[model samples]
Target: MDGQEGKATRKGPGAPRRNWRLYGVTAVGLAVVCGVAAAVGQVVRAGEASAVEAPKYAVGSGGGTKLDLPVRPTVPVTLTVYEDPRSPQSRAFAQRYAATFSHLLASGQLQINYRLVTQSDKQYGGSGAKEAAAAAACAEDQGRFAQFMDQVWQHQPAPANDALKDRNLLTGLAKKAGKINHDAFTLCVDRGQRNGWVAQSQSEFAAAGLGEAPVVQINGRPLPVPPAQLTPAELTSLVSDEAQRVATAATP
Candidate 1:
């Protein structure tokens, strides 16, 4: 997937397979980042030239003049995450915070939906990465997107590595996630039908000026800087504050 901007092509064999050791490295990184997201509200500032529009979700809230996600005070907030399977940062975020998000979901505090992007391969050299995106989409057909995403994030390989694209790995992860039929998952990956969804997500990311992984949007607006970078405590506070805002707004 490696090519210069505007001259990229999606053609090549997948990268080498990763050993189990890589998983350990990713796990450690996720732990550290999770702690950061929990203790500090750290987010990378958008580049001055990032060209991202004021996200649709931020158009009306007094905080930034953006409309908030139309969430009912009694219902959990739904967060949509744009991610790339080949990106380590995305994996780390998923590993560290997905469970917390799940807790909020169960408690009616938050909900989440994920959109997988496959554009990195064109810049990073993991041509097969798109395959992973397709596989996850296929898993979604079986109502297994959440399970598939958890596996992908838990076992995400380094960028430019094709290990994440292996059919066996995808199937193994799906099986581990308890997909009802490994054969169905395998068939889906082999057929490559879901690549369109990946392409659409990539297009959306590009239009949004999100050139990397782990782009998070609360409701429809991008999270402010501190929370964007997964600063633990800061993110927690922000979520709490936003939740309160949503709740108060709902009161008579």
Candidate 2:
């Protein structure tokens, strides 16, 4: 169903499961930074350099962009999320959890790995989901993915409108994101540099056999209740309980 209301559509079939492994509940060292698209020159990380023509984001053994607060210390939880920019549910989920996300991230109790899904592109007959996801990846290059996505939801057209492929609209939103390199953003969006990365993300989503968009997993498992149906307090309790459990296990 991919969590789009009013329609029952199956996800794509027979996609290869990108190699997926579960991270233990132990403290995470650091979040993965997404590599720049080929259009941009090589990026050096910690004195190591690699060249790949395609846009490469830090992905899990499964899939998703690993995002976390820069100031956070070692923590015991990671939230694995799947979303489609074009999906109304995904937007609502983002809005609904914005504060909770801040609290969790600041507390160093959680980090998020976001997987952008494009199932709606197949069901709704447009490339908006894929394009938007790629564009967001481009924003990731500038360390503005979260801000760029906020603009995306704020300006998202109707599902059937299929307006995301418009470079003007996308570039305009990049401008709204503040401090982003307007020329680079426009070039990345226009050239579809991250399209391959977006496609691989979607493939990994499908291969997991997940049924819908707006999926939230705690420590590699879905919440006991559907994320949309959960209150912030409930979510906090859930994460707190897990953190406590992990602490208990680590006690000498």
- Highest lDDT scorer: 2
lDDT by residue (tens digit), candidate 2, 5-108: 32333323312222222232121322222223322334435234543333343333444444432443344888898999998889989988889999998898
Candidate 2 least-lDDT 10 residues: 25-34
Overlapping backbone residue pairs in candidate 2 total: 1
Model 2, runs deviating above 4 Å = 1-74
Q: Which ten residues in a row have the lowest lDDT in candidate 1?
A: 8-17
lDDT of each: 0.73, 0.82
- Looking at model 2, residue 59 earns an lDDT score of 31
Query: What digit string (tens of lDDT, one per residue) describes model 1 on residues 4-43?
Result: 6335332222222354468778999999999988665433
RMSD for all candidates, in order, please: 35.8, 32.9
Task: List residue ranges in candidate 1 displaced over 4 A.
Answer: 1-76, 226-228
